[model samples]
Target: MSHEEIIKTTQHWLEQAVIGLNLCPFAKAVFVKNQIRFVVSDAKHLDGFLDDLDRELVFLAQAPADEVDTTLLIHPTLFPDFEIFNDVQALADDIVAEHELEGILQVASFHPDFQFADTEPNDIGNYTNRAPFPILHLLREDSIAKAVEAFPNPDVIFERNIETLQKLGIAGWMALGLQASQK
Candidate 1:
């Protein structure tokens, strides 16, 4: 499909499948100038499987719509499991497919120790490595070596994702709290 075609089709899928799937209680639509976002619920039906384009499309198609896109941020805690860790390759493939997307999607992942705001670099094992956008459950911030295995280098990965977002030019930060009922 042409770039325009891909974007239109993907947006359609997002509206029809992702939002419709109702996979999470918090699925909803988010409208940015150039992109649309889908806030996810605490559901794992399609974890680690979305690293491929086809799989991602399928997921977007199968996702439920009852929820609202409160804050479509991506984080590893959302998909915590060893299986997703082991199948990183497949997951990456699905993500690679997303490149077919005319524009880009921004996903977020945080390291476990990120909460330790006062901790020093040395005190922490090593958070020098860069991680992929939707951090794999297996990769952590402290291990640059492991992070490198996913990309050429952790720094490059960080630089690239950040740069990509900057280039997009229209960015917003939203925090959609998980409802108490989910717990």
Candidate 2:
């Protein structure tokens, strides 16, 4: 897909799923403030992707918190298989540590097929993390800490998300039009 379409689709998922479903309660604030950065990776290979990862890590680290609270580095075609994408997630973490961002910054991943461990492929709970494409979510630790503190019972967020998706069911999620993300 074209860059514009890729970005638009990601935004659509954010609107229809993340924000609409209240998957991540903290997301809406930054999203409305335009603090979420959507960057489509232009890497040609895994090695190149690592370079792109390094660049984004540095960018997020140096940028002011109010200007860019988070970043979604979307790579449309590099990781079609969830396993490969999952493995690369470890490397992403290593990069953050290498840059000495272990506590200050972190990386979370989301993909069309983001299956949680021990869950069936079609489990509704996995939908909590599913996104339109392979996404490396760069988050600020401070922001997370602050958000968690302000939110009531932050520990129950995961259980709440599972319950929410379970209530929505797979069919309901499909109705939301996120199946296109599986591409």
Candidate 3:
């Protein structure tokens, strides 16, 4: 698929799955405020993708929070394997630490086949991190800290998300039209 199509699909998933299911309580705020940057990377190699990621991290760090609070660096062609994606995610996190952005920035990973360590492959909870393509969600640590502070019981977000997705089930999730992109 083309980059535009990938972005549209990713946006649709964000609307119908992430926000629609309330997986992320903070997502709607940034999304509605148009503070989320959706970047589609066309890099076919890992090195090129890492370069793009580096650029995005720098861009987000330098940009004003009001103008760009978060970024979804979507990679459509690279890291199709979830394991490889996870490896790259680790590298990205290392980059953040190396840049001394440990408290200033963070990276959240997502993939079409995202599965938790102990969960079954088809577990509904995995859907919480699933997206149309491999994505490194770059977020401002300060924003996350503030959001968590304002949110009640932020520590229970993972369990809450699991409960929410379990209630939704595979059938309900399929109804959202996200499964089509995975295939």
Candidate 4:
């Protein structure tokens, strides 16, 4: 698919699944303020993808939070399998530590198939992290601290998300149209 189509699909997933469902309470603000950066990776090889990732990590680390609070490095076709995506995610995390941005930045991940350990592949809870494609969500730790400070009981977010997804169920999730991009 073309990059525009890829971006549009990713944006649709962000709007319909992430924002519309309120999966992330902090997301609405950044999204509304246009502080979220969406970078589509067209790398056909792992080295090229890693290079792209490196650039994004540095850019996010240097950029002001008000101007770019977070980034979603989306790879629509590179990671066709969840396992490969998960492996790449580990490398992405390692890059953060290697860069000495351990305390300043971190990498979170999302995929069309984001199964948690001990959970079935089709578990409703997995929908919480399901996105249109493989996405490395680069975030600033300070932003997380501030958001958590302002929000109540941030520790309950995981449980809350599971409950929210369960309540929504597969039917509701399908209605959101995010599953259309599923591999």
lDDT against the true structure, each candidate? 0.31, 0.91, 0.89, 0.89
Worst 10 residues of 1 by lDDT: 173-182
Off by over 4 Å in 1: 1-40, 47-72, 75-78, 81-93, 102-125, 128-183
lDDT string, candidate 1, 1-183, tens digits: 343543444344334323432221112323332223332223354553353323334343334422222122233344444234335435544553455522222223322222123544322211211121223222112222333465544445434433443443222100111111110
For each candidate in turn, give its C-alpha RMSD to the true structure in angstroms: 15.3, 1.4, 1.5, 1.4
Model 4 has a clash total of: 0
Q: Please state the error at residue 144 of candidate 4 in Å.
A: 0.5
> Largest lDDT belongs to which candidate?
2
Candidate 2 global CA lDDT score: 0.91
> How do the residues 21-131 of candidate 2 rate in per-residue lDDT, one tens digit apiece?
999999999999999999999788999999999999999999999999999999999898998999999999999999999999999999888888998888888888899
* Pairs of colliding residues, candidate 3: none
The true-versus-predicted C-alpha distance at residue 142 of model 3, in Å, is 0.5
List, in order, the clash count of every candidate structure: 25, 0, 0, 0
Residue 49 alpha-carbon offset, candidate 3, angstroms? 0.5
Q: For candidate 4, lDDT tens digit of each residue in 1-183?
A: 888888899889889878888788889889889999999998989999999999999999999999999999999888878889999999999999888999999999999888888988888888889888899999999999999999988888888888888898888888878683243
Candidate 4 segments whose C-alpha is farther than 4 A from its true place: 180-183
Which model, 2 or 4, shows the larger TM-score?
A: 2
